[model samples]
Target: MSRGTSEAFFDVVEWAAEQPWSSGKVGLLGISYYAGSQWRVAARKPRGLSAIVPWEGMSDYYRDRCRHGGILSNSFIKFWWDRQVITNQYGRPGRAARNWGPDTVEGDLSEEELAKNRQDQNIDNAANHFRDDPYYASKEYDMADIEVPLLSVGNWGGILLHLRGNVEGFVNAGSEFKYLRMITGRHDLPFYYSEEVEVQRSFLDAFLKGDDRVGWSVKGKVPPVDLVLRKGDVGFNDAQAEKAYPRRTENEWPIARTKWTNFYLTPDKKLTRLEPLHTPPKKLSYRALGTLEDPSLIQFTTAPFEEETEITGNVVAHLNVSVSADATGPTPSDIDLFVTLRHISPEGKEVFYTGTAGDPVPLTKGWLRVSLRKTNPDHPKHRPYLPWREYLSTDRLPVIPGEVYGVDVEVWPTQVVVEKGGKLVFEVASGDTQGSGIFLHNSPEDRSEEKLRGQNHIVFGPKFSNYVTLPVIPPKYGA
Candidate 1:
């Protein structure tokens, strides 16, 4: 809720260190909530807090969990709260399964009671505070004050909420002794994955026990950012699929010698490094509530690579766009863009990976609303890879009816080794597309659904030309 709530954790850390049997050393561990708490509490710069390994936790509550680029991120939050939160209440059915070792039990609740006992998700309370409000900023972990060593665990699938924060924490944190580990696939994999677990163990060992081996360097437990990046075709091995264990170690973070490639958007729905010379189509339009198959969707694809190309870290789209009045929702004030990154095989087929819901999925995703394009000017421009994101505002600026707006759509980070002959596809739409699942809002991003009136466009050409900046990691550096 507030930074005030962050105080309890430090209180616990201090109490633990004061205990006679305690070693006067403390470290925070756990996945998701447990991991997220580490960032919040550590920001306080607690006395006994020794180290933290925040595994797949969303550090920024507003930007990550509540909304994405000013639109409501519906399903995940509701499902997470209703299915996971409500189901584990003190007296709800299946509650015992979450209890401690010996006290766990099996119990069934009557329909009437189960229904009555369940609590409302109260999700509106979060949505109502849109933007960098006091409530959310309070919950935000102060990266500047976190001086202790930390091992920021990350996931490609965690881009929806966890991935950005994990990487941001590592990059912005005040700690001099910090490292990052990014695995390819599943979100929960980092928790118990052997390789991931080992990374965690060694990190914890160096801090907690002052003794350890493996990837760990004895000097304050620091290790380079180890990414088990996804390889083309074969992808990650089967055992490492869910957790994304690499066949071999790859390059470090802030990838040295990054080759920034701009795949320019074209009117023909294809992308190429070469900028178009002729007066190509100026714009492409799509219904704000269009289906995944909407022909108006603007798509760009590059030719299959002739050699391995590794793409890691933030993938952003630099675009010039505009919106129409009464688009998709009740009013004409907003326009939503859901951009997806997909893989295509050389043999005229699309590539797919298992999703978090155990279904086939693709690489990563990004989103943005035109009016919310106000960039965080303070965000370092040198880091072209990371997106400059601020927050949604209820009284935010409105999109001009026909004016082309230059904006950067921050695609979530993706880690993959594209095999020779595998093509990269980028799609932009008013709403969700084929590969944009898991992160799906269930509800459309535009709120003016009543009249269903609006059309948005992605413009390209000499004047409105746009392109996506990819973080191309050189071939053999991490292979």
Candidate 2:
């Protein structure tokens, strides 16, 4: 994308509205980039923009697309920028030949001129680490400013990127008739599903054409949330099986009746509801800067569930952690924490779900740069289940050796139903583990040896017990 993208779209919307055949009420629709652009343009409050369906699009550019927990998501950014953005750039030669689009109407720009015009997103993202920095702050817009009717369809498998923004956008947008719809399956296929397409048409018809068949035009007539439950492992990337996973309606995101349960991490590697007490503090160490190829991590497993249990919504892990420098390498300065939630079946099989790229994935993942761990408890978006951090340059905390820091890791929201005898595993790793797919945080500049390479430890005891708070949803009355 281009700077002033929303403005450009707004101009086109205005022009289309004035056309002879136009209805004067335009609706925005699409997935991914098309979906992402809607948020920005809707916030601009474009004339004739009556409604929007931002299906599987990210709302926050900096937090959602470029960085994950203040660590640069370099891999995906590079891939997308190179394959999608640059190849489709205006005035780029050979586009028509490559089936990318027609060659520039104004003829192609010289390679030198093209280089001068475009900013390399990969390089810029790695260089800018804080949201408060100009590079990110310049792209910021207030979600609350958007007053259009919205249907934000988020993908359960979009754990690495668009999922957070969809949830956050729906929660923050100022639209009086805003609704959230959650879905599953591959990112590209779900949007084109016949049932999903019907939803898009119904919403647009309700707002744009005054066809209020679904009662969408009437306030409070329809439930504000529609959720697709990931009940069982239908196997990853199986569209047909995932479609049978069942659906439900709720009045709000996070489901108001959610039972926020804490599963304590014990020294014995068990995850229990009861907090451990009166035990000597024990440290579990893992080599820092571990990669997917050579993972160094610790796991805490819950006892098999005697009955069916449903885990849904956002998750947070409160850990008592510290780090020490290795004998020979440069002294460590910061820590990057990668946490994954995995589902295990009664027969001891790990259930995997479809990821953003159709790869096998765990339940969900979360990350945090320890130095940027200071959270804003007073922020309006802050919740007991979710901590909101500004990721500002001024919020940096010292990460001295031997100093233990109690930090909260915000695991991406997830949904999984553990069957009888099924288990849930909480994994804490030094770097990107399985299920990260192409969205790895391996930028050398961002995770330098001098800053993050060391021995990372999770201290466990009564005073320093670590626990993952899971949003356990119980059966609703009269279901």
Candidate 3:
């Protein structure tokens, strides 16, 4: 699939360069699908491809879009495949009639013929479970091969999709003059906002036209990272309100001064900084096979803060967990852990962010399929706050009933300012809960009743301490 796209993009680039009216240097721009394809074609180093601005697009097809924590993200794939992809196929019969587009030039393809030509991503994704499988491997590319000048824009509220890819792409891409810009707002509006468009133009102009007005082409003249701080309850989905939040520049990501703070979870359902003082083992249980309509979960919350505390960057949850089968039911083979971080305002209101669909969401979300809990701490990308998982067939671990296993779950990166008297809540659930929006993982075949229906437990003891490590950012001196 990526090969076909890259070939077509290369052909176009070569064709444009030879035209009499051409500038001979091509730059790419756009958001979503357009931005995503830029990563693939740029990695190939096509002729005349000078620069790229992948605005809110994913780089890794498997990790960022198809699977989340090795669990198939079926809902978004279905929504995207049906409406955004299939309906626009080149030879669909009634496209002109329905005002979608013109019919095929030679004639429309029959339904049967069309079916043979295209792959249904929804079906293909659910059938393939690991990164090493041929289905996913064919789409893989090394971001380091991209040597073009790059500007990757990521949205903080796009927790379900594009956010991680943009950040990861900027980090891994071999571009010596790459920059990362983070934003906060609904997915579509922010990209077209006048301020954002200006940033995009200045970057493209500096690289493509050799105009270095903004110092983009001159290394060290401009900070490599531009971040939007999400502070205060600005109300979700309102662009103007979101603008009130401040912006800052950083020389590096995960900010070098980050204080990796651990907040332990107690049997009493509290999140505190102090470690437990010699307590007997305890566990909290929730019904398995939970759903959005009927969620089954547990929450551990922190007390009101004595002063303002800002939590920004990647988060990881270290938990000792196990699962048990119900009487007379099938044996449980796996456990799906859905973890969410929420902010409580000083007035006791839950602070929500603008999710991908403009829906109210918590601070951030993370997931893990217990059977795929294996991690490679030695991997170059692995960090204390963000553990790397290969999600390959060979990495699959056993999830036996009545056996406890310790796992580190990677929560998507996020930012928030917990005001004085405000609080933070750490929630663990068996299925999709609030803030999931359209990106859900509820496939009957993947999360079958025979496999996941059971009692999921979080064990707590001196030997098994459950805690969430937050990337706490202190204010810059004298700022």
Candidate 4:
């Protein structure tokens, strides 16, 4: 099958050669599997493949699909492989069914039956062969070898599979000309499909087709390297059939002139920026609360704003943490931390923006699993984190009741300008707030169930400080 896949790709390249006035450059673009295949073929250094846009594609399935943090991520792989790969292929017939049979559905079945079949397949193929297995390693290509320009796109809400790879590829790829554009929405949202397609077309026209008009169009839409902030209506609509949003460019990612202030989370549930006079470490722990319908979590909010504040870019939450049971060792077990941004109006109204049009306004939001918080030194500005790591069950580092450890959380990217008198709020919890709906109701779960279900606590102290880092955009035109 791999041989056939490779042959078909080569045949496509051969077909490209027949054109009389062929442009030497070819740009590959697609979502998920279609996007994934581009990486597979581009790594081969195919002739005429000038640039590639791999949206929501994983470079290492073993690290991304089969396991996350050394724990099997079967639930995701099983569903994706069946829906996007197997079912689509097998639904046809002939050789397609032969190749994709076990991976796809052949007949109408209950959801439970389909899930069981997927789980079975996941177990059969699950292994840590990524490092030692030849087949797995072969799929893990060196992005450094891909010299062409690249526009890597990702979905922050797609916490399980696509998000991590898009960020990693953009940060690690060898291409000098690379850009990372992330949207906050559902994994299967149509905006991503249509909007990203437009972005790819404009990008390809500029670099691959050498179209100056399209190049200028693309360049004009890009915000300045510095922080730029523009507040207005933004959302997705099928009516505007363009590939990329008509973004209001800012001077920088997090408008530079804007001040980044820290509002500490107090033990008494107070949100203050003032430092404690003789602060000592404080510890707080909550048992797992809520089911798929209810949630056990903590919510924090600042007083109503006196003026407008526009926030964008990556948000980091630094906290000292520990776990109740040292499941892995003497040290406390590591748990995931979920953070969210909410807007409370003077009239006691709650407004939350999904970053989609017609939703309430959003300042920003972030999430981080304590153990999965490893940063990439290459792109410090971007602050990339990897969730795939092994655990040492023998060496327990249980959280000492009062000891302080720093946990930096990364929020999903957003562009929002809060109006004066609007309140900014932050919440910290142990479980999936989306699944349970404690603060804001996000439809999807960013982290996996296995990761979110673990027991953990957020420790605070004079030595252990917890605060949020916000990217503020300065006023436009030097105002």
lDDT of each: 0.70, 0.89, 0.90, 0.54
**Where does model 3 exceed 4 Å of error?**
none
The model with the greater TM-score, 3 or 4, is 3
* Model 1 CA lDDT for position 441: 52
Per-residue lDDT of model 1, residues 389-447, tens digit only: 65646536667667778888888777777778888999887766665455555464234
Q: lDDT score, residue 37, model 4?
A: 69
TM-score of every prediction relative to native: 0.86, 0.98, 0.97, 0.68
* lDDT ranking from best candidate downward: 3, 2, 1, 4
**Candidate 4 lDDT for residue 133:** 48
Provide backbone clash counts, one per model: 5, 0, 0, 28
Residue lDDT tens for model 4, 91-188: 24343445644533554555555455432444444543233444444445566666667777665444445655666666566765666776654445
- Give the alpha carbon lDDT tens digit for every residue of 219-304 in model 2: 88989998888887689989888878988888998898899999999888889998887968799899999888888899999999
Q: What's model 2's lDDT at 23?
A: 93
- List runs of model 4 lying over 4 Å from the truth: 1-23, 36-44, 55-75, 89-121, 124-144, 153-200, 216-246, 250-260, 289-291, 325-332, 345-347, 354-404, 435-455
How many clashing pairs in candidate 1?
A: 5
Best by lDDT: 3
Model 4 lowest lDDT segment of ten: 435-444
Clashes of 3: 0
lDDT value for model 3: 0.90
